[model samples]
Target: MKLQEKKELLKKTVYEMFPDAETELYHNNEFQLLIAILMSAQATDKQVNIINRNFFEFLKTPEDGLNLGVEEITEFISSVSFFNNKAKNIFKTCEILVAKHNSLPPKTIDELTELAGVGIKTAKVFLSVTEGAPYLWVDTHVHRVLNRIWIVKAKTPLGTDKIASKIFNAQDLAKLHDTLVLFGRYHCIARKPKCKTCPMLPWCSYKEKNLD
Candidate 1:
């Protein structure tokens, strides 16, 4: 099949499998969403949600985060990876949001990335989930799936991001991002992919596909 044809088939299958694909990190609002995404760096959604369950209650607005201060913030998210730095960045991010952005997460990538912990991936995921922006947010999951499906051939997620953006239609980028992440996380997993029953087995090119 043609490349675009394969992409369409892959997209349709993934969408059918996970029609409600979205960020697993729990957040009540965009402010919390941004903070959650920041904390999700180097941490799993399960881990982040564990902390956010009670942590988000103490933070409603940027002021709430500032009120807690870095020390307390660190304490709250101590279970997550790089808690000290994440807490410090969250504190600074809140300050910027309150003093500059009027307590709203910036919608544009450039402005969003200006915040303390909001990198390209974080900014894109925030916009894609919260605002439905047509951005190709490439994480390890996305990077793996795209390469396995022959959508892109690159050594790094950043390279995959650039190529996938050029290949996939802008209209499909947001859903594709969510779909591929979920697909990679659950079905097309890194270690032992569910390949025997996978719908994409026909199109998948991963050498280590678990056919057993």
Candidate 2:
């Protein structure tokens, strides 16, 4: 089958499996969402949500985060990995948001990345979720899934992001941003993917199919 044909089939199968897939991180607003994503670095959604369950209640706005300061923020998110740095970045980002953006998260990638902890991937995720922007952020799961499915041949997530951008159009990116992440996270897992039950098993290029 052609590359486009494979891509379409993959998309159809993933969408059917997870039609309601979205960011599992709990947040009430854009500020909380950005903070949650920042803290989610090297952490799972369940981990972040566990901390944010109480942290977010005390932190609703930029001013709230700014007021919490680094020490208090660190205290709240101490359970997460690299809590100290994340706390500092969250404080600095809140400061910038309050001082420049009128306590609102920036709308553009350039502006968003200018914040303390927001990188290209983080910015893409934020925009894709908040504004319905057509940006796909390739994390480890996405990179693995794409390579296994023969959709992209790259060693790193960054490389996969670049190649997938060239292959998939804007609409596909929007639809895929969340679905692909969910598909890779839950279905095409890293250690032992559900290959036997996977709809794409026929076309999958992954050599070590756990069919047994």
Candidate 3:
């Protein structure tokens, strides 16, 4: 099948497989979501969820985060990877939000990235989930899945995001992102993918070329 044909088929199958794909991270609001996404960097959703269960109760706004101090934040999230840097970023980000954005999460990517620890991926996550903005947020799962499936030959997350944006429409961005993430996490895993059971096995170039 052609690339476009394969893409369409994969999209349909993914939707059928996971009709309600959502971010695994737990959050009560936009600020919480932003913080969760930030903490999720180089970390798993399970780990973030565990840490946030207690941390979030004390943090309701930017001011709350700022007041918590880096040391306390580090202690709470000490189980996660790069806890020190993440703690510093969270503290600094809250200060920036209070001083510049009036303690509100910025609406645009440029403004969002100005805050500490907020990069393209984090900004995209906030935009896509909270603002309902169209963005191809390429995380490790996305980068790995796209390359393995031959949707893109890119070796970097930025490169994968660029390629995905070219093929996916603005209207399809949210659904496509969720679908791909779920697929990568469950079936098209990074280590040993379930090629024998994956629905995309027929169209996946990596499976056909490498696994077969």
Candidate 4:
């Protein structure tokens, strides 16, 4: 299949399989969502959700993060990777959101990335989910999936992210990130993809497919 054809198939299959595809990170508001995305860096959704399930109960706004302080935030999310740095960033992010954006996450990538700990990917994902922005945000799963399917020949997620922005259509870009993330996470996994049962195997270009 051609690149566009494969993209269509992948998009259709993933959307059909996961009609309600969205970020698995647990959060009730954009503030919490931004914080969660910040924390999710170098971490997994399952791990992030494990901590946020209870942590977010009291953390409803920037004032809540400010009230808790970095030390308290660190203590709250100490179980995950880079908790120390994440704590400082989250606290400062809340500060910026409160001081400048009125405790609301900015919709534009530039304004969103102004917050501490929010890189381009995090800002894009937050905007994509909250505002339905059509940005092709790429993570490890998305990068790997795209590369394995011969969609992009890049060594890094950022490289693939740049290429994917133009490869996919604007109308489908909003749904592509989450749906592809689900497919890559659950089916076309890094270690042992279910190639034998995968419907995308015919179109997959990976040389080392696991049939067993």
Write down the TM-score for model 4: 0.95
Model 2: per-residue Cα lDDT over 16-38, one tens digit each: 99898788889999899999999
Q: Can you list the residue pairs that collide in candidate 4?
A: none
> What is candidate 4's lDDT per residue for 1-212, written digit by digit as tens?
88878888888888998899988999998889888999998899999999999999979999999999999999999999999999999899989988999888888989988889888888888888987899878889999999998988899998998898888888788799889899899999999988898778998899999999
Q: Show where candidate 2 strays beyond 4 Å.
A: none
Estimate, for each residue in 1-212, the C-alpha lDDT of model 3 and write its tens digit.
78888778878877998898888888998889999999998889999999999999988899998788999989988999999999999999999999999899989989999999999889988888876678768888888888877878898988998988898778888777877888889877777777877777777778443353
Error of 1 at 99 (Å): 0.7
- Model 1 residue 200 lDDT score: 81
Residue pairs with backbone overlap in model 3: none
lDDT of 3 at 160: 90
Q: Could you tally the backbone clashes for each prediction? A: 0, 0, 0, 0
What order do candidates take by TM-score, descending? 2, 1, 4, 3
RMSD per candidate (Å) reads 1.0, 0.9, 2.1, 1.2
Clashing pairs in 2: none
Alpha-carbon local distance difference test for all models: 0.92, 0.92, 0.86, 0.90
Model 1 misplacement above 4 A: none
The stretch of ten residues in a row with the least summed lDDT in candidate 3 is: 203-212
Better of 1 and 3 by lDDT: 1
